[model samples]
Target: MREFSEDYLRRTRRGMWDDSREALAPLALESRSRILDVGCGTGELSRVLAAESPSGAEVVGCDADSALLEVAADCVPVVAGDAYELPFPDDAFDLVVCQALLINLPDPEAALAEFARVSSDLVAAVEPNNAAVSVDSSVDAEGDLERRARRAYLDGVETDVALGADARAAFEATPLEVLETRRYDHVRTVEPPYDEGAVVAARRKATGAGLADDRETMLSGGLTEGEYDDLRSEWRQMGRDVVEQMEAREYEREETVPFFVTVGHV
Candidate 1:
């Protein structure tokens, strides 16, 4: 419930399905295919598919978040809709593709049931590898409270209220036959200047909102040289947790692989 907006997440955070665009190419028809991209945040994936389909496919992306739908509309025909109860008629799409969706839904099975209900042929799904939930908290710090907290925050239901590992289980429960599932470890390098200053400012504002006394000291002197080392440690560990938290794909030959893709059909 404390997560940023969908646009903010796109700008500030690396996605769990960055490679999903290419992964989904094979599942769709050449052209004239009507594809429904459920949970199509920002419409990045839907637009790509629509463009690539030589047959001139119509890719419609849907999301419950209207704010994101505004942004997604720019990329494709975005609808203000929900995955659980799609507004279209039965078997409305030749293919239904949902990448990195199952992992974030509280009722992924229900959503998948909807996917099955609407999809006439295939249902392609991408999800995080539950076995890939590894962490490298090798920081020589005093305690791993930060690491534990970070993991707890991510491993729990997302701030946006999505499922976690249970998403995969829910997908498996679907009546859809498992056509193909691949575990991909990809990482999107997130450089600094990542609006950390804004975070500092927000924290300060929050401290002020609560009328905390140590706001100035905490923002200024509290970030001491020694504290920076701790902060750096926290940052790195938190970054890893973020990748896991987002079900982010792992980069080839990277230290960690946080994202994966899975596709199936009924």
Candidate 2:
């Protein structure tokens, strides 16, 4: 599985629930008594789940990473456990769910089966479709380079990165009855008066360190060393151009990551 820090989780999940309540309405979270959030990470979704859950509702966050559990503990009752083997009895939860978890796993169906085993009511997954991502930038080259790099990255992802769009089909094959599926576009923007993180990211790109750091992940996806080097070269050039634009206070970018919420009756 991919390792993530609290900061990374927070950044990626920013504003996820801002206008996403409608998509989640079918879950009927308020009526759920025992809610188990698997692979909770930093508890971004768990926090929202905690809020949506009614009084006395038990919303417990669970994950395999002990480190992440520490962070999640601050938001809700957190248990360190594996997704394949939840540390609970059958039909223990009224609702069982995971966010951005399936794409990282090699066998999501097996995990869904486990979710079915633990839940008497509902099972759901929120996953991203990397192929459906869109990038818009003030600089034409920046957008083009991003698309190029993203294409290679998507092509090489070892897991089911495109699982978000196909999650319903996968869930339908399980014992659970499919209830609802909704797509939410998560927009992350980079605009003027760039913050410390944005500046640092720009610097990393200009130095080609960002692409270099992804060498192994890209290789795992099927990118050749030569292809990687070429990508880095072009990426670095684009980054330099971005720096120039930044100096002119003319840099802006918006990236959209399409996510799917698939809910099933267990």
Candidate 3:
């Protein structure tokens, strides 16, 4: 498993989670309240929560990876801590917020229970809806291996610490009362400087993973002339399409893809 670097976290935090922050904003306690943000990559949400909290409220962000925490620490008071065993006393916080973290955990339920143990107030979480993938044919067409690979990678400690669809179920078992559920839709159109680097980085990483056949060959800089030409051509075309769409503002009016958001209170 490849542990995510702080650089990776910083790069991702800016672009990902278009929906989670919006869904969490309303449920967040007043600024004066103490809140803890688990898996606070780059402190994006932590900054928002801190600025929005009642004048005196404190926001604390924690992640296990010190590399990421270093970047996050600049924006918020960050601690190196584990979600399963929080370094806080019972009822230590007024609110606990975790987003895109459940699926990444080995024990989602235990993590939530730990949150409940530390906070006297509320526990809010957001996770990808695995069940909802059926609504999008393109993403759904990624096939079994790609799907399994994605799942495995997200669940790995070195990748996205995602907790997929089971986050809500895990939260339901705890003592918190369900407060609200909202769906926020987000549509990402990748192109140019924003996506090119990421795409290349991903392909390089895949190549390093030693995938079988042409895929591995392609990554390892050993693809045949035809294979290289075909793949690169397709990639270039896709990039051009994205750039064109972005230029035409075609995505502005497009409906955001649906992602579930649930809020609960103690």
Candidate whose TM-score is highest: 2
Model 3 has a clash total of 12
**How high is each candidate's TM-score?**
0.64, 0.92, 0.66
* Model 2 TM-score (2 dp): 0.92
lDDT per residue (tens digit) for residues 1-266 in model 1: 12236744464224444544465554755843799988777776677677678888889998888888898888788887787899888889888877566666666778888998988878776555433443333223312433333333344333222333334456678887766555555554332333443344324322332113322333353344464444545545544444343333331112244444455566
Q: What overall lDDT goes with each candidate model?
A: 0.57, 0.85, 0.60
Ranked candidates (TM-score, high to low): 2, 3, 1
Better model by TM-score: candidate 1 vs candidate 3: 3
Off by over 4 Å in 2: 54-56
Clashes of each: 18, 1, 12
Q: Write down the lDDT that model 3 would get.
A: 0.60
RMSD of 1: 9.3
Model 2 Cα lDDT, one tens digit per residue, 1-266: 76777777877775778865666677788788989999999888889888877656888999988888898899899998889889899999989999989898888998999999999999999899988888898877777777777777766677888899999988987898998898888887888999877787788889998677667877877778898888899889888888888889899988889888999997
lDDT of 3 by residue, 37-104 (tens): 99887787788777666666888998887877887788789888899899999999888887667756
Candidate 1 lands at a TM-score of 0.64
* Candidate 3 minimal-lDDT segment of 10 residues: 134-143
* Candidate 1: residue 238 lDDT (0-100): 45
